[model samples]
Target: MNSSYANKSIAVLGAGESGEAAARLLHQEKAMVTILDTAEENKLRKKIDALGAEGIRVIADLAAEHESLHGHYDYVILSPGIDPAVPLVQHFIKRRIEMIGELELAFEMCKCPIIGITGTNGKTTTTQLVEKMLNACGVKTVASGNIGPAFSAKVNESSHLDVMTLEVSSFQLESIRRFHCQTSVWLGFAADHLDRYRSMDEYYVAKIRIFENQTEDDWAIVNYRDKLPALKAKKITFSAYVPDGDFSLREGVIHFRGERVLAMSETNLRGSHNAENLMATLGVGFVRGLSFAQMLPPLREYKPLPHRCEILRTVNGAEWVNDSKGTNPDSVEKALHSETRPVVLIAGGKDKGFEYDLLTDLVAARCRSVVVMGEMADRIEAIWKSRLPVANAGRSLEKAVELAHAAAQPGDVVLFSPGTSSFDMFKNYADRGNQFRALVQALPS
Candidate 1:
């Protein structure tokens, strides 16, 4: 695989990180490479210049028409963000051009042992935790894929690393025909990605294909609490309650197969949702032959990721938590259950066809006030307006925070767990969370 396509002509679709990096990698491999993007030529002129200097052709705007681009290239490397239904991409498919994801291209180039992590949630947290645990065990590894650098570029450059830890998204996994991994884990499932996939079954099947390419000799880890994962893998279950094959938090102590691993420690990550994330990380560590002693110590100092129930500051005795990563009803439900105190919930964004009815009941039971924002603010406000005091602050997050803070009592919690995406008001979840943090900090001390 490494040496077979050295001189083959390769066309890269999109000019984002994955596409650009893949084009660079393919060029470096001495493959005739060209990048085609829908981005304006004026906008990507400098990037095109850089690629031109690297001996790769760059076509932008209408100049990147599929017919002209696909006529000459042998293979097409797709950016994960592009929908296959797009006419240009569909044309390539019809022409029978060999299309693969950046991950698949990376797999061909990567020589190290791969450990891929996938789930509905907790992928980013679990990926980082796994990297830290392996590093503590004296293993040289870097976490990449959906969480970090483009996997193709990482494989092209990394020389001395012992392992590659990847957070594989369903979109990236969709085109992977033979992306193999030693250890793969499915955390849990719920309604998600209704916009990209035709049905939930299609979405889940894409995720499970991570294990579909593995052999019997390969290792697969799963959570016992999750029904789909056990059915998909040769199971090794971790729990928050009783001990099983590997790690469990029993009676306030962290243990692996009944051996005490770590004691109760100061980790800012609260709630049972995070507890499940910890269990999944520990399960991966145990499968890789890391000792319970070796794994637990590094994790003791581990910090919870920002925007996932991250505690911002104590404002007038009220605790504000940023959970901008909670982009669906299931995540919001978990965020609400994480605390016992009444919540002033800030939620609303671009709808991805997810139902908000479940959220209304959760808010009634746990939330004191619902502060709605973004484009779908009216829709969210309508659902909970009858049952609770709902405030509509339009599309501004700052105004939403101010309203939530005003509605929150001293002992209550103000949470930003928007049960939808940020595309309506911001670039992405990270940007949305950053703005929320900035607003929170600007409030009175």
Candidate 2:
């Protein structure tokens, strides 16, 4: 009997990257783990074989037997893609079966210090940036949690970094109880994942849990403007304009308040949003005694992560960007505002119940034309029709790219910064970005 699984049978729901990694880890710990998914065995045969080779049980197309399976298993480890309120989950809840996300399980297994990061927009960038700066300063660290490797899979004894910097999503933070971070950074929060939580307050509360287990000695690095997180943790504020905290980009120079450190006027990463991200990472470094001078090289050379303002290529003097990481209205607004030139924007996907009008207002103010795609394109097109030329790609990103590129003029920017998730058309933002780049490269130069 494995005490980690409470000496009871455990089921892992879903077989994506996180689910597979989690199942592997649970099996390594000698837990009686079973992997389940709705897809037919033929489609998931590869994953099933992999799990079977690893001595883990695999089940597929068991929708009819889901209730019975839940009743049998002691706990169900849910993948983030699955909704908490869905009928399958409600059945488990009604049956008194326990459920937790992969992050929760990972937190339980890893003994190293965890630095959890969460926000609507900048979590991935900040997490990677912190990992880079920390590595430069001789800290043994890895960036994992949401978009990359499962922290549980990355855990090893020989690991050099003393701390693990995690880019935790709201979904991952929902079930964490004992996952305490020595340093927690709440970059900023906005209305996101409303579809999952059913309300903004629930979403906010889930993200707020990043600092719930932190002691008074642990620091909560936060945005100066975020009120909810500021009240919860021992606060360390980082801002772009404000000069009071550890780091700020005042006027043009990137300044450090504590040590009077400042970077050169320009950086490799574009936009003031990047400036804010750099500031937050710098603050994290300063508190840890990581020299600002050591981090400056990576800071100067660090490139923006894909689909979040990744400049793909400039053709005919027009810059084409794959900002597919903009999966919400606020992110798209930031992407649009990041540039001065009128943008030929690609925006839409599975709607998360945010106000599309707010996005249209920004597009009207800056976008020259919008190439729409995905399930919610019609609604987005309706909002921006009056202000900008709205062209429908009818849910095809390839067509959307063609339309946007054709509409874009010299000195104009073409950006695929959709204000919604990529599930409607692709696996995630990475797939969307890959497809965009492939199509863009295939285009005649």
Candidate 3:
């Protein structure tokens, strides 16, 4: 426990999952905590009530009457979703008050050596894979950060002796001071989350911050495809497209430093992108002194997580796949590239302002039809209409499935790979994927 935080007056902004977890951890350490969330009380009432019962102040809104409380805060922990550019957060900057993200606080309290993973895509799958390989080799492991329980919640719940494989995001990395990882993995990167970043360079900078505090003893996993800078840690490059690396997946078998590690056919995963994820995780497994046999058991048993090309039961001889997690052009492109069957793609959602022209060529050749929905439905339809039969399903997932089913025939796939965020009609991508599965399962054969 940090004695410095024991009696400090900490103010937590945003009562989201990470925010509430941070507040709870701080409160447990005997800090005088206050939570401020713009969301309505009922939405987060249970968390609010729990904290209020613990004698921590819970304010739904920072009204004028309670505005004075902001200045008295010794430290402000902002959630990942809360933009630092906001006036309220800037106020603390001007006053020289300490402003750090929830992950920053998690770093302060978490004593375990972290295996951190970050990139534009495949962070979740790679993180899950790494955790599996570690545990399969008899190493204690826990996965967190943007995947399951927030880092702070995991910190409060688990012992620090366990190795933590964290799926870090640019938002969480933006405000770190001394958050360091023992081993870092940077998967392939492409244009993503432009809606939150000012420029591509700015986004790239936040992604590279994962390597900021590494030491000579630490391991840095890099992608040979993605250009990166010289770093202090011992760097190990992994790739699926090229063999000039410490680890490379070629001809179904993954080679580590010219030695066989694992075979792609041995695992349940497919696609070139998945091969990249496996190669990256294999690089980390090598550093841990793991063997092909040890990692193979877990890799063989592991299945793709929900919402990323998850195939439902065939109805009427046509396949239905839920890939609602493909919220960017690159991810959706990979999904399209990996599939062999002709697709009736259900695309569009809250657009991140990424260009879709690059994906048009792939869709033109691979997708038989397109069903659009949510915020970017019209824009996506306009861009795709000349290439394929595009139908507008509005913001309804059920309608989207209906249109996709109508367009598909036996041996064709109805792939719900929304190439944007899910904020328009669903709570999140997971909810969108689940709803899509439910609606598609109801479709008749």
What does candidate 1's lDDT look like per residue over 1-445, in tens digits? 3445679988888888888888988888789988877778999999999999989888888443546554676889998878877766777788888889888988888888888998888889889988888888898888889887878768854568888999999989999977888888777777788888889899888888888777767777776666653343455677664455365776556666777765555454677667777778777877777777787777777887888999999899899999999988788988997889989999999888877887777799898989999888888888889999999999888899889888988999999999888999899999999999999999997
Instruction: Score residue 442 of candidate 2 by CA lDDT.
Output: 82
Kindly provide the TM-score of model 1 when superposed on the true structure, using C-alpha atoms.
0.93
- Supply the global lDDT for candidate 2: 0.79
Query: What's the lDDT of the predicted structure labeled candidate 3?
Result: 0.85
**lDDT (0 to 1) per candidate:** 0.82, 0.79, 0.85
Per-residue lDDT of model 2, residues 29-131, tens digit only: 7778888777788998988888899888788877855654645787788887677777666666787877778887777667678788888989888888898
| Candidate number of the best lDDT | 3
Model 2: how far residue 232 lies from native, Å? 5.7
Error of 2 at 35 (Å): 1.4
Clashing pairs in 2: 140-160, 140-161, 141-161
Q: What is the lDDT of residue 210 in candidate 3?
A: 95
**Candidate that would win on TM-score:** 3
Q: Give stretches of model 2 more than 4 Å off.
A: 1-8, 66-71, 157-160, 229-232, 241-245, 258-266
